[model samples]
Target: MRAHYRGWEEGDGPLLAAVTVLGRTGPQVHFDGIPLIGRPVTAVETDITRHVTDNNLGLRFASRGDLGLYGLGVWVRSARVGDTSVSEARIGAEEWEEE
Candidate 1:
């Protein structure tokens, strides 16, 4: 699967993968080492970015045999400490005064 992006917001992005058939059998999606053939297809891999946030996203996956696959997992984005933009933050006290 592969994709390309050009600053579009939501509902836009090339197909990461689309295998209608694989090696003489119907293509399938796998989750956590299990085959998700008859499960309800619900999750998707999303890429999220908004001002000062440039990163990839990986979230929520499930399988059909899951009895209580009732929760989600993620390679979480850490609690962002502060804005990382250096150019936007002034260096001098006067920069913060008389504004």
Candidate 2:
């Protein structure tokens, strides 16, 4: 896992983010203690809804990945899963190789 602040807009200042290219999976992300999931990663979302609304309003997600617990006992429905996908995060840096 890695963090990358993919730049910002004119007034956006410094950015913050991460990226990890898995063996078979594409990119895996990680955060400090936990990430910020607004809503929930559910099968009920449509292409019209953006990630911001679904991954920043609930129990959020767990920085724990791969074998880590994915908000198992959490209340938020958006972060009750564990897999290799573009999960949302809030603060902190990611854990991964330098190159």
Candidate 3:
């Protein structure tokens, strides 16, 4: 799925925003997409560690994954868009690397 979020904040020359994505599955899945704040979206595929029981999937920045409590996944990325930011996230059950 492609997800996008937009909002503006006042007061600052440099724009900043944070984006998070989560996914869980029993089989191999790829959490890929461009989490950005501008046009010409770039696709970024995240390497997800597949869990055994319940297939818990988790993602974090510079942190140990598989820390989610309920099979929930979390990935945080920042976009320097100057106050307003948008995200284009896509999730699929197929291998995105092969595509």
For this target, which candidate reaches the highest TM-score against the unseen true structure?
A: 3
lDDT of 1 at 98: 12
Deviation in Å, model 3, residue 30 alpha carbon: 7.6
- Compared with the true structure, the alpha-carbon lDDT of candidate 2 equals 0.32
lDDT of 1 by residue, 1-99 (tens): 112222444787543221221211324434354343322222111111121133233222223111212122211111122442111011112111111
Error of 3 at 60 (Å): 2.7
- Highest lDDT model number: 2
* Model 3, runs deviating above 4 Å: 1-54, 63-76, 88-99
Which lDDT value does model 3 have at 93?
24
Candidate 2 stretches with Cα past 4 Å from truth are 1-10, 25-99
Tell me the TM-score of model 3: 0.20
| Model 2 vs truth, CA RMSD | 13.2
Clashing pairs in 1: none
Model 1 residue runs over 4 Å out of place are: 1-17, 21-29, 42-57, 60-99
Better of 1 and 2 by TM-score: 2
Arrange candidates by lDDT, descending. 2, 3, 1
TM-score of each: 0.18, 0.19, 0.20
Residues 19-81, candidate 3: write the lDDT tens digits: 233222112223333222222222232222333233554343333221221223333222345
